[model samples]
Target: MKEKKSAKTYKPLQILAIGAHPDDVELCCAGTLARCIQRGDKVTIALACRGDSASMDLPGDKISSIRSREALHAARVLGAELIEMGMSDYGVDLTLQAKQVFSDVIRQTAPDVIFTHYHTDYGSDHNNTFVLVRDAALAATVGNFRTSRPAVSKSPLIYMWEPLAGYGFQPEIYVDITETFSRKVKMLNCHRSQREWFRRRGGVDFLDYIEVVAKFRGYQSGVRFAEGFIPLKNWANIGARSVLP
Candidate 1:
């Protein structure tokens, strides 16, 4: 009889998702993150801004507080830890200070994979967040780039999640989220303040909008529901193994 090969065993990944606003991660890659959690991975959702200016009528501070609570609820729904950078809405910048802060987060989380906004995504906050995360992933592995935490041994793999409405983003990979689609919807619905904010500001039902986008991506990927991603694939961030759930 021929000898049988042993089954491969995989380790749980530490996933870090950095977003420009409270609900950005949920809007873009919640399904993928939900799949990661289902496979026993630990996920960290880091928001560059508190979304203080997302409301039409509420004061900045009041809306920020409400959004923070909503973000916590959303994190709970995904079973992920939340990190609020407390940066001002529309105020995220690609400064050295911002880089250091993100590098520290990378070190503290020690993620095996990272997901963030596409570089050319709409809004200054989202674009700056992409730059900050891209640069910080490198900084986190440099000993001279000092922070509250020590440098990580290796840079983590970085993947850019879809932009709003999938504009100008060509996904290199797709994750079938059909099984986790309901969880993704639940996670996004946790951001109740955003729903009302979008309705008032743009007459858009945020939930309906996201569902439509998910369905479109699913169609493109031949799945019932899906989320797409583009890997950064820089030399330092490349690895032989696949990290996505």
Candidate 2:
């Protein structure tokens, strides 16, 4: 395919996580992002949605602004760059137009690794997120797509972070974020809306719940805390030497 022509430049960033909602990336892979930051890697979180339609209490638009601001906070806490696609929160339909938008972002960021929601997710937004990211990343390398965005040289690594626990899911890779547990907490704390939700009315402690999940996943990696993901089978490379075992 003829590569697209552009004046845009690519960065040697190590990681990028795309989420269906504003906070999804932080919840799913903040720990991983934190670890990458510590290793001097440039990490980014691209929000697929502005999160305008995500809420049971606060007004969607109001909550959306709050969520957008909070995402910057979470990204700051993890020392990662955060970009929102500015798409409607729950209006992510799988389409060529959507793919074009996603492809543009991919070309702009030029990430080395990309993470998004699993396709078999509980929410339609999350499922569509997977489709969008997959198609976008693949299209980002093709020039014939005729996008204003420049085509990236190498295809970024693609990974899918799981939904909440009790979803009967498993991870193909676990990043031992023991050293970044505190940073993870810092990132999660930036999610003030979530804290207010479960803390004020729900009368439940989500922090404690996430603590257990972090520890459980960490245990699998023989660490203090961790986030897990299932790497895309075709996109990920493997060899005897690549096996963790």
Candidate 3:
């Protein structure tokens, strides 16, 4: 008898995660991204802003420089590439220029999956980041959009990570990050400047907050730790295959 054939194998995927501020990705989806890296997938973290206004004491330029260094450290922890858009804090908008810049990033990365902020998130910057990512993902596919990079042949699947405090948002998917939770914490810890800012301004222990959110999501999903996400279910963004790791 002829030998039976094994199942076909697929190559690793390129993932892109976008956030409004330097530590946003680490706060919401670092565990998930770490899990993806463990699976041999490539990941990129893009920040819409440098978080120049995050500090109460430091000047805009100084804080921006500090946050950039922190973000670079966090990206190294997660084994992901980092992209900074150089937009001002609270300046993310739905302008044509913003869309083109975002589109160029999408084109250059050519991601198979994208993770971004939810549309109804609390802050204006977060909400606008959602709009920009949503529009640019489509714009990147159009031949005549005219970005620095060439248009992508297909639009990538988009998933919105959980909002702040999981407010006004329900997840349609959950990724079990129990095994990678420590790595996630390490990535977040790299944002030392943000930790100090939160402690001094709000008396909040940033790491504790992250743990609580992860545990809550974990309980909901019957995992020790997990990250929640909502897919952009529009026809163009839906796909038959499961891409999350």
> Best candidate per TM-score, number?
3
lDDT of model 3, residue 216: 91
lDDT at 236 for candidate 1? 79
Model 1: residue 205 alpha-carbon error in angstroms? 1.3
- The lDDT, on a scale of 0 to 1, for candidate 2 is 0.77
Model 2 per-residue lDDT tens digits across residues 107-139: 888877888898888877899989888878888
lDDT of each: 0.91, 0.77, 0.92
RMSD, every candidate, angstroms: 1.8, 7.5, 1.2
Greater-lDDT candidate between 1 and 2: 1
Off by over 4 Å in 3: 1-3
Worst lDDT 10-window in candidate 2 = 236-245
Error of 3 at 108 (Å): 0.6
TM-score of 3: 0.97
Candidate 3 pairs with clashing backbones: none
Q: Which ten residues in a row have the lowest lDDT in candidate 3?
A: 3-12
Tens-place lDDT per residue, model 1, 1-245, is 99887987768999999999999999999999999999999999999898989887889999999999999999999999999999998889878999999999999999999999998888999999999998999999999998899999978899999888788887889999999989888987888889888888888987898789878889999998888899997897778888787
Per-residue error for 32 in candidate 2, Å, reads 0.9
What's the lDDT for residue 217 in model 3? 92
